[model samples]
Target chain A: MIKSKLPKAFLLCVFTLSIFIVPSLFAAGTQEDSSGNPYAGKELSILVSAGWMDSRYDETIARFEETYNVSVDLQTVPADQYGDILQTRLLTGECADVFWIQSNPFAIESVIVDYEDFCIDFSGSAWESVVPEARLLSCKVGDSLYGLQLWHNSPEYVMVYNKSMFTEMGLEIPTTYAELKDVSAALYAQGITPWFIPGADGWQHQLAFFQIGGIYEANHPGLYEGLNNNTATFKDNQTMLKVLSQMKELSDLGYLGEDWIGSNSTNMANMFGDRKIAMAMANSSYIQQIKDETGTTDEFGLFLLPLADNSFFPTNPAGPTMFGFKGTENEDLVRLFFDFVCETESLQEILDNSPAYTNIHVNDDAVQQHWLAEEKAFVDSITPDQMVTPVLQTGTKYTNDYWMDFGADMMSYFIGRIDANDVLGRMDANRAKSAKIAQDPAW
Target chain B: MNKRTVYPVWFVILPLVFYVVFFLMPSIMGIFYSFTDWNVRNRGDLSFVGFQNYIDIFTSEENYASGIYNTLKFTIVSNIVKLIPALFLAMLLQRGLRGKNVYRTILYLPAILPFLIIGLIFKSVLNYQDGILNVGLELVHLGFLKQKWLSDPEVVWKTIYMVDAWRGIGYVMTIFLAGLNAIPDSFYEASEIDGANFFHKFIHITLPMLSGTIMINLVFGITYGLKVFDIIYVLTNGGPGRTTEVLTTYVYKLYSSGQYGMAVALNTILFVITMAAGVLIVRGMSRKEVEL
Candidate 1:
């Protein structure tokens, strides 16, 4: 009996010790190689615009922090002030370890003209292969990768209208510019706001003109190439002039909301829910947002922005992208962070966390995409040929750099302070200024 | 006097160093940068461009000249709107009113609030379609008087002046109140015994006595008006088609868009204008004091 008891006691002691010691052994075993975990105690800082990162990156950033035993300092600035703040910080050499830009093919060359001096070249980074081919233009400045763009491919800046409201009014969806005008007039006659232009936002009103790049390209043929190579100018562009004139006419006729110029988008979703406005320019995802915010079962649908009789899609591949700052002390950590965010788990976590987004456009098949049914149907309805290159702002070389200036010019034109031709001329002058600053050979 | 007994030169050394470093160095550097082709593209490697930035500011089709004109207009008009009423209010509330402290607190309240908060509150209050001001007018059967407070170019400047005055009058009155309090009651009493009316007493005793205070307010108000950015930026953002574009707003736009050299040139221009105005006002006030 004593011998049996001694054996049982020894077994119990071993079992208790295993509970504490085995996990430690496993933790020690899983410790990465010295080169792999070299940045255990370092910190990484990222500066971004408000909505760019939000909480979608929280889970992935937390996972990365756990894995590397490091912390990430995320600094978010208001959208309107981000450009000025980023430029100032960059000039002062006090920029964060990582910074973001709303990047396109020409953004690195035009927006951050001193890319070589400021951006860390991630030419041979492991995560390069994860990005899609088309997105490479935004991330690379001539073969050298300077940014990491992980954004969705949702239908952007289309006409989102209340389907129930249109049906209730017995109005068919407008397919042409003339039809749109007629619908707007009918709605205006009914004492309803036909179209809502939140001009106070300073950025929203320009989409009606730029999103119809297909119309401009079809009319001018080599317009994007000409604009880039300095062979053509926004000045005397007949299609653009027509679009601007039509927009102003709508404003003058009061088809747009009364005091639209003085109004902002704070109450836009509520207005849509209450049926105060018929249609507005927004992303396809904003339909979901409106439904969610108002808890209204109002059926919303997307249509091509019918300005200038445009039937083509606004194929904007541009989005806010991150870049590693060249002047950071923790280069290895920055690279690690980049790689970590591209992992399958991290990608999935980001997509799952982003309630505003439905999918993440990436080349990896391991990541499951959550495409909304409404967006999918809209995408399917557009013809293959009509899905052209990006909108005018993102397609052209330096045009987007002056988006705010063009918006201001458009406002000035609307108020009769400046002529329509003068507005176009100002855009030309702005493009020339950007070309000069970039030292582009085309200019 | 023994050399040791003389005031030590070190007494002024720290402040002199601070002034040179903080104020003088930055001003000189700003002037120097205005002469170069300093921009975001070049960053630290700026090239000498002579007066190209200044020429561009004046000659460019962007209507920066209008901005300069607007700045001067705002300075003169805004000061006139505030100073006269502020003086009258100061005298009215100087004595003989119940709840004068309450009135004083109410008036001084807006001065202590940040420009950002004031802008946010007033922007909402002044909205055209659903704003309290227009809505109240509509409810009172005065809908015809409801104007587009921020959108209409014809009325936007007037609206801005109103808002500026609303935020500024109380503070200006407070300064005048301090000056009013400093005056001995004997002068006013003596003037009253001499059978002088309120206007006559104001012109003679109050005006002459408060000359120093007026000069101080004038200098402060002039500088504030010329350097005005927050109010206009928060209100119209130099909008309704650059109708309210002031020098500082233009300078801000240029700087934000990476035209650093041109921005500094515009600032240099404003600095010169402000200095000239200050000197002229000081000299004029000094001459008046001597005459008195």
Candidate 2:
């Protein structure tokens, strides 16, 4: 009886010890973590825009979990609805542990002026090295770095054509605005819509005119700066009016497809697959999506849009960047997660998983790039003359703020409710509205 | 029993408390927020800016005015479009029609299906060039009738009404059926004995009896129409140049774009419209009750 009682007493003591010591053990264990995080069992939630990041990052996530013993709940909202959902959550004060914003220099200040309220300051993070100076301008506001944009350098928002289609028709890629018109006419004569602008997309159609901002700025000189300062206006800008007219001409001439205004990007792949449309404005990676989805036989090629005799690239450096919510319960965990993502192995895994991406712009040398031969070949084919200035929408103030309005005005122009100059005037008025809201001196 | 009679006012207190907390408080708070400069950038640094947002809403050239107009139009048109056809279908199914249960089930299926699924399915079916609707029309040599159902501003409203009716009519019919069942069979028999024809029976007995159901449908339809966003968003996105813009869609745009103050103001306006409509409908129903 005494022996059994002794074992029971020992067992009781052990239970009591466990009750007292288990939490202390955990606390002590996390105290040793070097990344300034002591919440090992905690979770970090990151909300992202869909289609911006591919599934290849799953490996990196798993590895990060293994290394840190913390879970990362990466929720990617659908691209179209993301903005609204983010805003609603933010307003309701139920935002996730971390969140992403598509920011530029002006965007962080203009769109998310309350970034300091929500942002976890990363002014001196080691990961800042990977971003180029031009790109850094978008990630920073004042002396603080609030966003990390590791976007690929690609030929963006330019006219992508079926190279095989051009070759089969014994035609060369058009080099001038008049040549584009001639090519379009020839394609139509052969029973194909030469340019398939999915106006119903409400986002894609505007790129044709907006991405050719180099020509407009070159002609007007200080046009964007003037607009930013409120001294210049989008209305009566000669080059912009010409570009808008040219777009209208394309729509009117049946080159932009019969029902271009009503068409969505959902069917563009099928249209290309079936050889109904010869070209569209898209990113270099989109060719892969088209080929994979439709199994199209036509090989694709990129060309600069011939608006205003322009030869500039749309260097769209904008992408989702993570920021720590100030109100998060596990702020330490969030910081650790960011540090883990910047590590070489995790970054490499992310790039490796992205089959659709050619490269991930990062400062770490260990992360390998997966640039395809075709992409390289396309880059090689571009002459120095064609590599003009970057488009000015992103760098300037209060311009990207009116993206949706400009799109609507362009649609109005297409539908004949407004003229080309009126479309320009609307942009100016919308800018003035934004400038007033911003309390900018330019207005 | 007389000795045991008590006021029992405590029974009302719980529900009253719940209503004040959940419904009344939030509504009052929403109205208060609308009057202030309560935006995302301010981070709850609210200051009263009375009627500025309201003024901006009305004077704004962007889709706000059209959104209000579309909301009113949809409420009127959708109710008429759904309620009348549903009443007739309810009448037909009440008769000795063969396979009525199967028909009812088939009709009601769309009503119970998720709105997201309906929006997705209809978007495909209504595609301009190769959607099944257009293709079917072409196959039957009715190609001329085919239009860009979701894209053409002229016909987009019609398509929205059609899709909404397809989803809502069966539910309305079911309600009408319940009303039809509640009406005494003896009233119809007495009408028949009085030498009343089918139209005469329908006018004298059916019409007066089904007024409750019609009122219910109007209330439901109006509320639904006022709050419509998902179907239009999935189908047209207030596009072909905001031609299909409505009040809720406009509110959604503002909210998503981080204009919380403006969004709240829009919602307050919608709430006022819905509340006023609801009160009027209830009052009308009550007056009809007294008359009956």
Candidate 3:
């Protein structure tokens, strides 16, 4: 009788202990996590394009997760498909806490056109000052800030060429389109691709035409204003026509590459190291990348792309900008993330982790920058007048959104399927379509 | 027909309700949306724009008309390219070929592989500079024959067709193999006794008996052809330029650009095409059945 009674008592004690212990254990965990933080158990989701926020931000994000005891869901979409996917997610009202865009000054007004409805208004946030003054145009639609631009203020998409190769070949950096053609011819004679324009990259090839917006503005004064005011169009623009013809001429000569349209820039550094190519359209920082990646002792330098006699610097203040999705359940958490990313420690971490960029463009005084001397030299060489005009795509309204479309049109023109005029005409029509959608009075 | 072969009305009622609510209603709504100025911007309310969207598709300088042309061309050509080879392969394997099962498995392997994987592989294989095909050609004495397979406007469509055929032929052939197996060996044996050669037997016996299977393939091929997107998208992305852009790709672009009205219009055009093709195909099959 004692033994049977003991067994029943043991069972009852075990069940009662479990009931008391389990609840307390959960309560302890909850208290521990939520003790010092209001957003301890919340989640922050970021939707970004593939290359925008890579593994460089992983550690920073992890730190944020640990400090706040929160989880971050990072959804990186492939660059080619990001636009469609973002649009789909936004349209379906299922967008993440944060989303990113390849933003320009006109982007907030043009791309995320319904910015007031879509983005969280961070007008008076302390983090707004961390962003550089030049970058605010891309980040702000007006006095209201919607995006955080974390990008380098270095020369972007300039002609990064092998200085050693050009010197060895007895060639000067061509300042005119005709001289550029001659340089290409001389390189092609030696069984080398003179200009490595990776057409397969989808958006790389159009840089030759659009990066020279200053030249276009110089030739056709107030062209940017004309374009924005709807008093002008890309169609039948003689300067644009001349530039297209020169690009076609290069294509016809096979100086761009044996098959630029079929190839990507995956092995570009290796190609540079091997001295198989003389030059390419790349950022000033790509010089350092070539040295680090391929150990190429061959010195590389930057030049203005000599397409259509472009002597101007591509003064682009645009880059990948992140915005808070207004529809998020964790609005405070989203705001916290924007603030967290702007902190000096986080800024330093991002710059240290980013191998592609030599310097961070933020206005923080504490963070040390590793700016290349090559960049300084290139900037010094360009005249003050030359740097006045922005790149063609960003200067005009609603142009950057049609980047991929224009690239496709350029590809067609290069392959002999369509004339140059048709490409220009399509851009005009596409811009008009954007204007119609925006309900812009300028149209 | 006996009542035993027929199920109760209530048996189908649940499935019918599910179809109407989930599939039929959404499709009808999509059609309705196509006639309006509904887009990403105007999510709150919608306004009717009639056939203006449809008119814009043909008239717009975006050259959506060419996309329609490419879609139709791809449909006809891709079917021809797949069906004939699949049929022949099925016939060859149906005979007493040694190691037939091994061959069948190997051939059907590609069919099981997803299109995304196939596209990535082919893009590498067809790259003009460092691709295996061009390199192999150069390794041999056939370097002169090498062309910019994907970049050349002339060859881009051909490359797309080739890749599509590679992925699809096995599936087509598998269906043909099953149909061939269903055919009685007695038909061929009887024909052989009557001095019918292989060609004669194929023309008289095989063609006549395979009519039902042929119709099945045609119906499937036509439908698949009309909705073709993945192959074109993965391979060239409707480029070297928009030379390979199809209606679906265009629809996707327009939709992504937030021109939902235009996108829906393109889709509606595709819907009309598919419906018309379906009607013609069904009528043709019915007439053939009556004749038989």
CAPRI-style quality class for the chain A–B interface of candidate 3? medium
Per-residue lDDT tens digits for candidate 1, residues B186-250, read 99899899999999999999998999898888888999999999999888888876788899988
B27-129 in candidate 3: lDDT tens per residue? Answer: 8888888899877667667899999999999998778999999999999999999999999999999889999888888888998888889998999999898
lDDT of the candidates, in the order given: 0.88, 0.80, 0.89
Candidate 1 lDDT over A1-443, as tens digits, reads 99989989999999999999998787655655543776666789999987789999999999989888889999998565577678778777789999999899889877777888889999999899989988888999888998999998899889999888889888989998899999998888888898899988777898899989989999999998899899998889999999999999999999889988888888998899888898999877778888878888889998998888888899988888999888889888888889999999999999898876788889889999878789999999998889875699999888888877788888899989988888889888888888877777888
| TM-score of predicted chain B versus true chain B for each candidate | 0.95, 0.95, 0.96
Judging by lDDT against the true structure, name the best candidate.
3
Winner by TM-score: 3
Please list all clashing residue pairs in model 1, or write none if there are none: none
- What does candidate 2's lDDT look like per residue over A121-178, in tens digits? 8888887886778778788888898777767666777788988999999877887889
**Each model's backbone clash number:** 0, 5, 0
List ranges where model 3 is wrong by over 4 Å. A1-43, A69-71, B1-6
Q: What's the residue-level lDDT of A78 in candidate 1?
A: 59
**TM-score for all predictions?**
0.89, 0.87, 0.93
Pairs that collide, model 3: none
lDDT, candidate 1, residue A27?
63
